[model samples]
Target: MRNITVEEFRASCAAAQQLEIVERKGMGHPDSICDAVMDNISVRLSEEYLQEFGEILHHNIDKCLLVAGEVTGIFGGGMVTHPMLLVIGDRATFSAEGKDIDVNSIAVDTAGRWFDENLRFVEPEFLDYQVELKPGSAELTDIFRRKEKMLGSNDTSAAVGYAPLSFTEKMVLDTEKYLNSPDFKEKYPESGEDIKVMGVRKDSDLDLTVAMPVVDRFLDSEEHYFRVKEDLTDAINTFIADYVEENKVSMDVTFSLNNLDMPGRGMNGIYTTVTGTSAEDADCGQVGRGNRVNGIIPLNRPVSSEAAAGKNPVSHVGKIYNALSHRIADRIYTAVPDVEEAYVWLLSDIGAPIDRPKVAAAQIIMKKGSVESVQDEVTEVIDRELENIGEFTMELARGMVPLY
Candidate 1:
């Protein structure tokens, strides 16, 4: 059988515009018309409206079409406004403006019920939000950008409704959990199945739990794309807000991660104690009396012997260190109060008689919860801990050093 020309079909279509034409196999179909209209709308629709309808399509496409009838009484009937073309076999061919477009047939179930049951358009409320991350904060910005990448991927399904968490943000929490656990493997047996956790050790800062949402796996369709996009956006925003809150504690304090042993005046000798004092044989003649205080010092105090040696105005005064400690304390206090116990450590070179006493140390302070209230106690302790050292101030200080 020879194929009929589109012109002939159009002439026939014009003759029986109202005829309940029996849709023929390999002939133009109604669904094909709808599909074409939908595709055109998707591409030409304003981004604003696209987002709006896209969201609706994500969860309610069926209702959008069919539900309109319930309230308006204007669908599926003689008004000819909401056109319903007949379907035959698995193909629906229709002629429009002398051109033929074929659409794959929808199933009876989909055509009769599901297709139009979910696309009801309703008056909706719109909400607006502005991101609050600092503009120049690279880490926060990077995290945000990463989220955008994940959300904007071609996977429309994940892009549509899925959201993901940042690897960096999640790492911090995972590190905390792992460090606090007595037997991480036992506590988290599934660790064996995690390819990322192979060699993790105790007290390590490495965050083995970092993961980004794999939106690629589900981006096969428009519906999934919308779903993933919503989810990814929400996840990123939530994580950022929490991170910012935790780090806000150290806003005013600064800490140094570098060596802190040099006096402003000159290089002091090794921080060794000498029994003999100045020309006068004073009671300070203890043999083991080395000026260099060798061990750890409280992070709240100056740790360099040079500080005490030159009485260098700021020597051993704990100005910077105390400021840092207080900042941490402030954050923790604000976030979590009533910490029953806290531990802090500092390393120092107390004095300088010997050639060199390197001043380097880490603070390891722990505090017990002081309050009887459960939520209050947990929050208070966390706040205090965050205030003390959670902010990246120590990291920020290196870049701000004066150019010598």
Candidate 2:
């Protein structure tokens, strides 16, 4: 608590600014796949550790690589000549008390399970697996065995988070979610899962460019593809209009789908894939290269480079502090009427208790009051979140929180 500090935020919020940009990679994006799969693997590994050892042993399993596969597609269907390779590499508690943990089996199995759940068309049979997990260093492993009430921090790391998504950020996120939603997919079955939303807002007008690849199996010809594309575009426009009016946003939005189109170029320029994901052939993915913990990649705001997914949920400050900071910032903005926006930063020292960070700071953009007026409320928010660190870690362990 001594390290906690709250102050007036001097910088202008991105929402109030004139020019802003935001991007959200859908769950089927190669990078998102890596992040989600590895994170799910960590969760499964944590559960196994809990069931076997009565506690989660030390591990940091964030490293992952997704190698692209070979495929050829025509107007009707596609063939996968080679499967995508998923290389999961990281540290884990392999042996404890002379008993070995089946880390590789858990990692490979979780990756398959994740693919089965997230991507509608992609299957584990289409993926190649490689697990490179090894036991963590003794120094880091000993942190979990400490006599302290809480597990000591695994590494000296810093994480920052901010509250209140910007208008462009929300629009990008919402657009991707809408396109990938089951209802939308049921109506437009050709749409691929590897969707990306890019939003550019200048003043009140916003331009949204979406990349949604179509599954080749659903298309009969180029003409049919164009017709479906037009229908999808019109449908998205209708959704955006409803979204704008429902949210009471005065901003004018223009939406575009799949900018890469050359009608006469055969299938050379068309964004079509075999599976619902580009991972079948077009692209590759890696952990931490996708979305941030908050889900949207905010380019204008302060961001932490540390990736939360796949990290040990117990003592990895990278995962815990990044998520907790957002929770703290959101709580402060919601609880204090005078606060317009809030940003929280947390820095940890190795071997220190997870609840007590070396620097727990909050920056508030006040609407009507000075720093002293809402200091107690803001500090209480941070203190309360830190005090409940155990419950928060359990949620992370159980995969209840979103890391990407």
lDDT of 1 by residue, 79-184 (tens): 2122222221211112222543222222222333322332111111110111111112233223223323111111111000000112222333333233224363
lDDT of each: 0.22, 0.89
lDDT of 1: 0.22
Off by more than 4 A, model 1: 1-171, 174-211, 215-219, 246-404
Candidate 2 stretches with Cα past 4 Å from truth are: none
Instruction: Let me know the TM-score candidate 2 reaches against the reference structure.
Output: 0.98
Per-candidate TM-score against the hidden true structure:
0.14, 0.98
Could you tell me the TM-score of candidate 1? 0.14
Clashes of each: 86, 0
How accurate locally is residue 31 in candidate 2, as Cα lDDT from 0 to 100? 95
Worst 10 residues of 2 by lDDT: 117-126
Question: If candidate 2 were superposed on the true structure by all CA atoms, what would the RMSD be?
Answer: 1.0
Please report how far candidate 1 places residue 264 from its true position, in Å.
Answer: 60
